[model samples]
Target: MKYISYYHNPRVSNLLRIVSESPGLTFTEIMRRSGLANGVLSHYLGNMEKRAMIRSKKGRKMTWYFLPHDPIEEDSIIISLRKETSKNILTFLLTKKLATFVEVTRAAKKSPPVVSITLSQLQDLGLIKVTNGFVKKYEVANPDTIMRLSEKIDSTMFEKIKDRFEDTFSYF
Candidate 1:
């Protein structure tokens, strides 16, 4: 299943926060920590499960819920952040290295107001560097690292496809 975006969901955020505090927790415990009703927690859990952000093990009596992977990992953090904000901006920053507000607006094909808000939010998260001037340079922080990591992780499926295609057509 495709990963459902959970970046802005309060329950998912609370769930992640709770999981970060303590890795392995049952749904009941998570519910307790989140102070959300079972129905609400269940919906969040289902979404997280679809995203592979969290996993569950069905015991005879109860089910346990926890992050299948590390929450502090850079990719996980990026995914969570993108889920919470404009993924287009993330792509633009990662691809363009640095972009001013105007540049982002054009690249994202979004309105000036929307682009400005996204840029401001990313700046608040310390993900981008924005400057004020006639010709402002909004350099992406750690461009090399973020770009390299994104490429490494995102290329896996494409690499596999390329390999398969080569294997099938190389003789021709």
Candidate 2:
């Protein structure tokens, strides 16, 4: 006899579908897309997490959610790049190829500390490389792969997040 899990409720299913479709969504973002109330979403998220149907990473401001062993594991870079500051820094580096720390801070319009931390995180993830010498410079490790992965994600959901993300970050 097989043991059936109780995580297949409609609400839980919807949450899983959303996370699977767009991995690395913050709790707030997931709530927005799932239309689940804060408490309700929290309950389902916790339950799913306990069941090992989901996993989350604590971001600078929010907890980002994802499915375990996501189908597009190669696209995990897109997941980490979901943060506004990280997105801005990487996008800037993708366009500029190589840039100094001050250039990244200026182009990305982020503060020195935020840029520094985000750059370090990207370096640790192997998504970007930083060189320190007379000047510190940063560059994306795999522009083509990042681009391809970015294109492969669901555009509709990504657009929704991107729109809200830009709106949320514009105030900062």
Segments of candidate 2 deviating more than 4 angstroms: 1-8, 59-61, 71-79, 132-134, 152-172
TM-score of 1: 0.45
Displacement of residue 146 (Cα, Å) in model 1 is 2.9
Candidate 1 stretches with Cα past 4 Å from truth are 1-69, 73-77, 80-85, 148-172
lDDT of 2 at 11: 84
- Model 1 has an lDDT value of 0.63
Q: Rate the local accuracy (lDDT) of all candidates.
A: 0.63, 0.77
Question: C-alpha displacement of 97 in model 1, angstroms?
Answer: 2.5
Best by TM-score: 2
Q: What is the lDDT for 117 in model 2?
A: 89
